[model samples]
Target chain A: MLSKDFVGGLITILLGSLYLFFAFKQRVSALADTVGPAGMPKFLGILMLSLGVILCVQSVVHSLKTNAPALVEWQGEGKRFFRAFGLLCLAIVYLVLVSILGYVLAITVLLTLVALYLGAQFSGQLATIAIGGAAILWAIFVLLLDVPMPSGILL
Target chain B: MDTILTLLPDSLNFYLVLPAILGVAWGIIGGSLPGISPSITMALLLPFTYALEPSMAIVLLASTYVGAEYGGSIPAILIRTPGTNAAAASVLDGYEMNLQGKAGLALGISLYSGVIGSFVGLFFLVMLSQLLAELALAFTPPAYFALGILGLSVIVSLSDQSLVKGLIAAVLGLMIATIGTDPVSGISRFTFGVSGLLPGIQPILIMVGLFAMSELFKQASILEDLRVKTSPRIRFPEKKLRKRLILPQSIGALFGGFEGVMPGAGGTIASFMSYNEARRWSKSKDEFGKGSPEGIAAPETANNTVAGTSLIPLLSFGIPGSNSTAILLGGFLVHGLIPGPMLFARSGDVVTDLYAGLFFAAIALFFIGYAIMPVCIWLVNKPRPYLNAFILALIMSGIYSINNSLFDLSIMLVAGVIGYFMRVMKFPFLPTVLGLVLGFMIESNFRRSLLLSGDDLSIFMDDKISLMLLTFAVIFVFGSLAKRLIQVLRAGT
Candidate 1:
């Protein structure tokens, strides 16, 4: 029901509060300067908190003046958010598998699965592109650039 | 000039030449893709620079910027979509010209105008950056602190609709910056016992995550556009058309030269302003949007000119005015080269090498732009799924190569999610990046100035340079606030 600005402001406030708590907890040394190490962090925290409050106030004022709820909505917003979340999950899976499966295998599997996930047909052509693409990347990163890749269980 | 001859031998080196050509080729390919921005294109290349010499690495990144700016027009002319934000204005007359079967001519004019703009931008960059750097030589700790504040002040302009949100984003970035170590003291602040956190989260990781990975995430949710397969040959403008284009190109160059130097007023704005001005000045103003050569010439020239002139701030003041230049600044940091007045004194050769590299990039843009046309068409026509998948794979691989640590990869993915939410929230990324990049400098200098004055705040007012920069920052912030207030009042009325 809240506007995006109101929600965002709340989140910023939460973050600022947490940051301020940690900043206050930071230890200072006897040799530390007059303002010390925690000074900027403390300043940034207060600044963020103040700005967040201002944003919240502004959003509330705007809603009151317009006499509207200002509910945030976008067409297909949920679907898009979920789809993006899915891709991120898949990337996380790739990261976990990468150390176990090695760079070439993990990356090849990632390429194929992501392609299919994004609406590619499960054809031999897709296979070739995925395999070929992974191999080429391998050659470029490991061979030409001389940068090491995660070897893992399989070469 | 004696400067040119002195730098000639270094310019002719094979190491520099190869990166310039390769960077341009890669940039044209990357930029011609609709979703790939110049910053993302450059960020994708950031990890690879670890193996390169400092000069070579900087050249590669800088040249990519040059190529990418020009490359954006390919899609603007061929398809209705602009490849980069700056190329959006080109879509009007560019696509119109394509529709009228003058696609090749349109392509030629874009390329030609872009080169002219590049040369013009380079002239200003060479002339002005040195002068500015000389002026900045007198900077004290307070002055540097004020400089950082001045850089951060651009956030007000960067924030589209909300100063509060922009300040919030910048504060968040500053918080992230504090996670590594306390600059004045030897104590660590908020590392949470993670070894990787000690390095304070590399700006490149944040950049690649924010710009490239977040873009991919967004693309995943959207339906891919149906590919249009048409290979339009490029044809250079004849003498008559060239003469006609001169006025519009000059207008673009001047606008771009000025805009590129201002923080946050990047290529997109310059292109639009140049297009409008060119229309106002044109004798055949009636043809402004109906496939007018001037329309294509103006925006294209302005955007490409921005590729050179945008570096002026980065070179002179160590301040990155745009996303692409921020990535370039990352390149400099990667090489242990700090950009600023001290940079000129310490690494003058690198500066000269950059000049040489940009010169090579401009020449390479002319030749490579023609030869790479078919490749650009073919690449863009490929299935969106394959392109997205490969790009993701590239990002993952590139992030791993940085420290050979999986922790960095995780951090990058987290940053990507933050970037995605930031996009959804309508929060700008540049201010956050500016904060992250400039945070340490601001904090260190602020503390140092205070230490010198025994915690007295008046030391900032005591120094002339510091006073001047702080006054500028105040003007920028208040000016932005006043403008926002006016808009709010008008809306209420």
Candidate 2:
């Protein structure tokens, strides 16, 4: 059985140290009082560093203790994780493409891909959901709410 | 009182009623689904309220919470699964009652209890918030700063399992809040040369991404085939049974009101505690988990009661007491309105409208829950893949609709990933959000107070209100740690 806390704690510790360095290096005005622009960041950095260290210790202790609750990672869960991660990657690419491809086109394409990922095919149901859903949202957001969406190239 | 007379008529208008009912309808659908929460529902629907009047928007979000609290019991009774966390206790007797061929009875009791609890909770909301607001009217900048610190200190209590993880999350949120231009210095802090960062990151983006997107990502792992019967489920309680429900309902209202006012003890805890108390005092205690009416009534009533009363802290001190109210805080800020004692003094009319609308939502829950139970059950039992896809599309489109920035979309996706990691590690999400909400309050006020004085730290100690608030914050953090330590030591022994 493997637990997530130790790795999470290590990440937090690294992030905390980075923030602590950034906080200490910032220069502010002489008129600054006991705390200034750097004050909050420094305080938070120290807090995170200390907490992360303690969490790392706790995770180690719990993992070693015989009486501690078992924390198991299921086999084949990696496939599920990657499946969701793949959707996230698709999202990031679609976001970048929105600047050039326009929201309607990008969204239609993205939604089609998402529907497919969720098991829908490039059939009528997928077309109606992907295209219709995008059109309806564009109308609601742009026409009704007056939100200025990117028209973009090839719209 | 006069404001209520004026605002009561406005709450019934199409603008207010439509969103309120619609939010309720959406809330029920969301609540009846196992993974969807009241906060997530509110977060998803928040962007849609951009076109709504501010008063109407508040009503819409608040009413959604009210409806979701009751909607959670539907799945609890029909299936063994509790839709919302607050409904977990209801499953003990609710599902048992269902197995005994009394599903409608359990649902009817749940609805009745929710309405009664809501009315009682609303009374607490009006009385407590007004009283607290009156007290807060005398607070200066230093006091407000201390108050914000006190709110942040709740992370200690909210992180019941591990305070260390909670602090890390809060610190992360505070650091994120420090992005954009420094308020006091009039200089850009961490914009990384983006013009959109000038106004700082939108909390709504973070909220939708954290709650909605993370849930969508999490849904990829869960594969369940939910089933719902088309049988009509409209059973009203007999007069004799209604008499038996009163004691547990009263107990639930008491526990709910008490917990709602507390920062970290939310509706889930309140319902569970109320169930214990209800069973302890009931005549038929042996039937507690074996299809007793009191078991269903106690938790359902208690959780729903938290809906209105949880807003007391938000409305009075500009500090959200729960995650759902945190989203409501976002709703307030989106409209360029800040809530506090000033809100009561300035926008008394809007506050009145919200109260009237809450009153309307309580009554509306009964009619709406009865009318739409079958539809919600059908929707709940629908295939997960299509449902997840639709929700994901709704969230992404909704996020893009607000400000229409590619950068904002990226921020949301990043937030969703961070939120997912936080969830995986069992860290509390509430503190991170409160930190974000209260970060500006704590920083701006702390510096402003010192600048107003001649670099005098004693000014904070001099002001009675500010000193009291800081003292309370210190005690809260230290006291919670000490209590948790004692419990741990006792367990080890």
Candidate 3:
């Protein structure tokens, strides 16, 4: 099986190809005008294409030469990945709901959800994390730093 | 230097007192915490400085920069976990000495080296930056374009696993850079008619996204498995280890200074290189990887040394030496201060205050270093899952607070996703961000240089400095290609 490195390389190469195509179209202006804005991009597009070719060649060579199967290792925890992703989604939802529910309420709920989702090891640490996060945000942004955060109608 | 001194007297009362104490405390706490960088601390404090007298604000920011470098060493020596990337090298020998029961000796060596490097770098920053700024007055648009290209070439050395992927990411960043308004021709390349894209992406938001928020996204994914399981034990170093560390630390500081002067080389490079150098030069090289005092001393000294002198280019020219300094540039701009020759002549008071603060900040760091060492050791060695979650929460809140814009939050999430994939594939992300920042600088300068010379291609080759910079860029690119070729040949063999 091909490794993540190999797959990632292929993906990048495809993206580079699309960019190169657009850059080539723009190069007509570079050829016609003096100091065309397209010169650098055209140069970069060609350079990227060359790099993409090299990576593709290297990946093919590695696939051919290796006798043993490509190693697949999970670098770290799957549970952690899910928890972080879930919390991130919750943040997005909070952002969307903040306009309707108000900034303070949305942030308070988001903090509580994130603290719990992050798996605070201590029994009542969830409350501490939530309160602490909210307090710090309020003090730093709302009061001192003067950044405008959402204020819910309830607040 | 005379100009800097003349303005020192007028602001003596304000610059000397409060900023020093506040800066040192901030540095200690920020430095002790893993993943908190001094640059971010300065950026957060930047907005408040707008309300203060110029001298006071600059003084406070400079002090924080110096104090943070020393603060990072505490955790490295105690827990075998470095608080910042710069301190990562220190853990090798420092933790080994701790295992052998000589934590005090290791701490002593780190403190001593930190002070020495700080003093040396300060002396150079004061003297050399002034001299360079004078020379920088002669720089033209063509010169800046060449310098930008040279800076971008440094990315080759930074690519971790796949140079190809790194190059692609860099090019992509450069493309994104073209999306804003063009300075010379006034024709936007890819702004796509979005009014918000007119001013281009702010450097602070990009950095906050690239460094801070993206980091939290990746950390969040690892929150489940990141349990603090280490048992805490502290012991002062033996007399023998103390004697052994002095020479190694000195050697590390020398390389650290060299790294600082070179643009694009930051703490990570300095620490790793100096650590390896110390091992190579040591009598008990085999003790390295296992536990050696020299291993820790070399890297700790180098990291701090690099941290101070890295400001040389940022101050002397308008160029940033590292990611941290790039963010610092935003702070400088926030105060309506441009960092080059204009500031030297126009805002001399601010310059003097910054210099004074930097000098005292190093001194203040020594005290903070000792006081916080024990706590840092405990924090790292003691397992506390709750603290990690707290840190994660802090990172999220801090990033969100920077720009109340929901769009920036989304950008942060997208950058985080990109960062995660890059890290997993062993592709270097630093180069991508650096390329992005430098891309606009290069494009604007290149176009202006062309327009200045009536599109003459000979102008780039005409200037001596531009010639030298382009030469270096060619060498770096070819050198990267050669290395890849050699690797391929070895693989074939």
Candidate 4:
């Protein structure tokens, strides 16, 4: 199996190559001064590619010397990764629905859902905490700080 | 004396005082919670500072740093869990003292030592920043570019074992910095036609996503025991105990003052070094780990000392040496203030105001550290889910408030995911942040110098300041590489 460094290095190489491609594609303005806009990006792209290769080489050398996989296995990491992914999905859902549901309602739902997902018991107390927390935040951000939160037909 | 009188009224003004106290109070609450680091705490507050006066915003961020250092000890003493990374050193003695039913005394010593350390750090910060700022007054474009390179070189030291990974992360950051309009040509490079991407991503957004959101994701996955057995009232040390603690506190101050100014060596290293040094020099070496007051005092003092001195590099050269200072730099940028030698020249009042604010923050820490204990304990005892949920809400709300644009929120989420992967991959974050913050400075200055010298590359070596700075960068990179090589060779043997 490929080591984490090897996988990470491959990803970086792909990213650097893509970035370099974009840098080259950037249209140079007639008024472009010395070095132009693409210069730094081009440099960064090559540097990243070089570093990725170095990392890949280093990992290979270390693995050969050890004669064993140096892969770090965190207990229940897969489960944890899924849990985090679930949380991210929930956040995305909230973002998509926020403007439609309005700030207060959307935030209240977010608070409740996040709490439940994180292992809080579903109860009246949880509802109260979620509703109350949303109200407080709304007051602080909207009324106090004068930041206009997204609003919809629903309160 | 004249300077003191001149700064006295501004420092004492209600605007500054209120923010100072409020910041410290908030910091203590955030810091006392396990897993909420000082950087995250400050990052959560970064957007809020957008609406604040520049001086007040800076003071608020700076004071949070001061309070967080002391706040970290509360959990370290009470629950055997370090609230911040720096507080890890305090756990050895602090938890032992708690087990021995001397928790109050340990807390007191930590607080007292922290204040002493802050004052010591403040003295050095004031003396050194002024001198460095003065020296940096002659910086040309090439010199600024060299300074940025020098800042980037700090990444070598920051990359604990993997220099390659650190450089990759930094390169990624520089790439992100390139996503907006080009500085010189006024043409969009990588915006991909998104109007929001035209201004580029705000550093604060990236910071909050990386430090706060990614940590939340990690915390959501892990189940930890957050129970506290008891809340103890703090007891100030008696005369005899105070005398005994003096030596360790001094040692902590010395180590902290040195480490705080050095790029990439923050409170964590300083605290650990102080603990080791304090034990080595102690008369009660046998009691060092087993509830020795000096043990708690040394590490606590060192971390808080770093709170003040860490600002030295940021103020003098616009280079943040640690995560917390980077957030503070974000605070400065939000208010259209750029911190450096020119900062002192253009906004000298802001610099003086920061000094005043720090002095007041130290004083506030003493009182707030005591008064807010019950609250800190109460907060720590809360269920993890609710706390995490509220924090997530705060992050979303804060990110939206920055531009009232949903696009920024999306960017933040993307950055958060990237940060999560980086954490899993064991890439150091400071390098990425440094690259993001310094990317423009490096690129613009490099091009500006070349343009001025008619595309001559030697302009970098021609300027005295630039030459000196470049030399330092070379030494730093080479030195770190050499050290790493030796470690690898020794391991092979």
lDDT of each: 0.89, 0.83, 0.67, 0.89
Alpha carbon lDDT at B385, candidate 1: 94
The worst-scoring run of ten residues by lDDT in candidate 1 chain A lies at A68-77
Under CAPRI classification, how is model 3 graded?
Answer: acceptable
In model 1, which runs have C-alpha deviations exceeding 4 angstroms? Answer: A67-69, B483-493
Model 2, chain B only, scores a TM-score of: 0.97
Instruction: Give interface RMSD, per candidate.
Output: 1.1, 2.0, 4.1, 0.9
- True lDDT of residue B244, candidate 3: 78
Error of 3 at B124 (Å): 2.7
Tens digits of per-residue lDDT, candidate 1, B1-493, equal 5556766787788888999999998898888999899999999999989889999999999999999999999999898888999999999999999999999999999999988887788777887877786765688999999989998999988887787888888887788888887888868888878877876888888888988999989999997775655788999899999999999999999999999998788999999999999999999999978999999999999998899999998998888989999999999988888887678878988988998888888889999999999999999999999999999999999889888889989999998998998888788888888898899999999999989999999999999999999999999889988988899899979
Give the per-residue lDDT of model 3 (tens digit) for A11-67: 676766766666555423433346566667777777777776677677767767774
> What TM value does the first chain of each candidate achieve?
0.93, 0.88, 0.71, 0.92
Q: Distance from true position, residue B449, model 3, in Å?
A: 2.0
* Model 3 interface RMSD, one decimal: 4.1
Stretches of candidate 4 exceeding 4 Å from the true structure: A70-75, B1-5, B489-493
Worst 10 residues of 3 chain B by lDDT: B223-232
Clash pairs for candidate 4: none
| 3 or 4, greater by TM-score | 4
Candidate 2 local lDDT, B1-493, one digit each (tens): 4444665686566666776787777778788888899999899888887768888899999999998888888888888788889999999999998888899889999988998888888888877876776764688888888889888988888888887888888888788898787778766666657888888888898888888888887776666677866364869799999999999999999999999988788889999999999999999999999999999999988998899788988898787878899999999888877887678877877787788778778888888988989888878866676677767767877887777667778899999988877777777788888888788888988888998886787878988889998999999899988999999999999
